[model samples]
Target: MTPATENPWAFFDRLYCISLRDRTDRRERARIEFSHMGIEMRVEFVLVDKDHNDPCRGIFASHLLCMKKAIDAGARQWVVFEDDVVFHRYDPHILKDAVTHLSNGSTWTLLFFGCLIKGSSKTGNPRVKRIRYQALAHAYAVNRAFGEKILSQPWCGVPYDTMLRELSDDYLGTTPFFAFQSNAKTDNEACLGLDRFRRCFGGLGLIQLMNEFFHAHRLWVILGHLAVLTGLGVCIW
Candidate 1:
């Protein structure tokens, strides 16, 4: 994993891709996609069995395995990506930049390449931002310190991304998304889970939508839209 540049901290020496043994098609797809992005690496397949039937548990177990492997390999930090992840614009420089940035300290528990998160005050660095929520685990990097912390915890049955989110407020995400899951393709749709809210009228659905909406818009933009809507309603009345 050598970077094209002379920078000492440019590329991640240890990178792992988690794939399901049963999903050979996805495995092949991931291999090709990662290769295209110059991420030539080995895939860590997590075979499904009776004990790992639960998708959440399977994800958690796979991540834990990755962490252990990193520790055994004597890697100070490692990058992990799900098989379905698609690199945004497929640039090697961006990935290298993230590797360099997040490698700065052990306090940065996780640096998400792609996620659904509430926007927060921008950090001076464009490559990182404060993450308020993390809904996806498509791509991320963690250091040895965080890996040790993860190993110390018991399996709480929570989803892997949610567990990682609760572990620390130090989680950061790359703006403009370094990578994301390939959801537009039909073959890739199986990994997409049911929406958190099945019905908009349901209390959870409304809350989820509001949260997403508010997080996406700036305060002034939201207020301006509200005023325009109110004026339209009055004019119609």
Candidate 2:
């Protein structure tokens, strides 16, 4: 058992990080970050190979697999992180204080270090707060029962964060997020036919064009061009 004075993170049975097989760079970053936080020994890496068809499904499968692994390992409290995770505000007692104020996580179903707030959320304690829904499963903690509960359900696909939120009746999260997704190439993007086209076009051009034009003027110019083309087509017809 972790001593009462120890940080709440000490109570976690293990910390697992999910990374793609090719992302050793991400793995090393986690290693250095964990060592900085003095928790390197607790982290275990789960390497996943991306599925050519869909990476999101691969992400979902990896998370489920982590839950199963934790349960099998008899982990009572555990944390899961994606390779892109970056820790923020590292101190011995910052997170400890939040956990302590929340009755030391006695009522926690899911505890998130990184999550996106939705409309259904209500504001209260920033240190430790209740949340209706959570997204961005970059970093989150789970108890043994919580892990088991998630595993028991019939689930599929990515957007795994939202799925957990729907299943979780009692969830808690940190405000000013304790973790963040690093500004790196996203591994979970599934580029399908139309999506690939959209991405290609979206990133292809027009930084200067967007900067030069006001929103309304841009719209008007586009409309004017369309009208001229329509008139020419009508004349030709």
Candidate 3:
């Protein structure tokens, strides 16, 4: 195991963390835990006002705000994380190695250090794998090129992770996640419901499928999947 003190990658210097103002306790805990693991971060509080009616919207807005801040700061590459993330068990060496591999590749746009879904063997790389559908925007890194592209676009109503998944040509995820939410147990019920829904109604759900079909240019793939699912439904009926 690599020593926590030395972060091999310079990209870590540009780390930014997003936390809600009212959730200082979670922020402090994350800060303390990350520090103990030798990871330093600049924290930005996402203050939710009356405009942000939905908590999910507030989260997405905060992420966009952080990306803009990174651009203004002249950062070429940066990492962003939510306050609920725990970094104590993260392997800095693996992250650095994966990033090094990705830096050599031209297709990758975003590198997810932590995600809800893992890529299959078809999408696997030596250091990273191309993700199909990743949820949870807990922790990720983006280059300035990708950041600018993201800022140029309007806010799509989908969740942050889904938006990234759709935009990037090759969204990479590490085999062993670099970070994890401290409050994973709290979201178990929600995850169970989502899993059930995905299995029964097809992946991404009907609304998200329609949204992706409309917004993203990759229509044939979505259409093909929908057709297959329709056939299956008809056969079952």
Instruction: Kindly give the number of clashing pairs for every candidate.
Output: 0, 0, 0
lDDT of 1 by residue, 173-204 (tens): 66546576664332223243443222323432
Of 2 and 3, the candidate ahead on lDDT is 2
Q: Rate the local accuracy (lDDT) of all candidates.
A: 0.65, 0.69, 0.63
Model 2 lDDT tens row, 1-237: 343487567777878999889988889998887787777888899988997677667777888889999999888878998877777665556567556654544556777776555422333544656655535688888878889888886656545766786785577766535576665556555545534453454421222123223231556778999999999999999
- CA deviation > 4 Å runs, candidate 1: 1-10, 42-53, 90-93, 103-106, 184-217
Clashes of 2: 0
Measured by TM-score, how close is model 1 to the native structure? Answer: 0.77
Per-residue C-alpha lDDT of model 3 across residues 64-121, encoded as one tens digit per residue: 8878988998988788887777653366667766766655554666777666553333
Give the clashing pairs for model 2: none
Candidate 3 wrong stretches, greater than 4 Å: 1-6, 41-52, 105-107, 122-125, 184-237
